[model samples]
Target: MNENLQSSIEFSHESGFDPFMESEFHDSLKKKNPDIVINLISSGLHKSSEKYAEIFADIGSSFINATHTSIAINESFIKTFKDKKLIV
Candidate 1:
């Protein structure tokens, strides 16, 4: 990577917050006010078939929370992208 490109990048990490908690997740988003958000949360791996409903619920809720928070912060930032593609 070019030194200039690397120097322009910024990263932040916050610990001990549960994304499933709507209020906590919204609060974190409001605090960060990030230009882009890439949510990689998943609960579908290695689970038994009996837990499919729970897994689906978890993913659904997560997606809803992320979408709501992002729209609340900046509606213009919402755009569909191909998998793993980060738009600037």
Candidate 2:
């Protein structure tokens, strides 16, 4: 995972990103917005299946700052994987 992340960071930098951001952040968003805290839900520890996880992801934090607020647009897909490594 570390190697993959490093590769990603390097790729990002090479692609013109001044500095790649960290994958994980211990941000205190809950304290900042108490309303969104109770709604905190863990995805899972580890996964062996992608069928259930391939739906949608909260990728807003990747580019937006959650300090005071956040915004994101959803790109939905209705197709399922049918090739190798494809999940039901």
TM-scores, all candidates, are 0.26, 0.19
lDDT of 2 by residue, 8-48 (tens): 33334354644323232212221222211111223342221
Give residue 43's error in model 1 in angstroms. 6.8
Error of 2 at 7 (Å): 3.4
Q: Report, for every candidate in turn, its global Cα lDDT versus the true structure.
A: 0.33, 0.25
- Candidate 2 at 55: error in angstroms? 9.0
Where is model 1 more than 4 Å wrong at Cα? 1-20, 43-88
Clashes of each: 0, 0
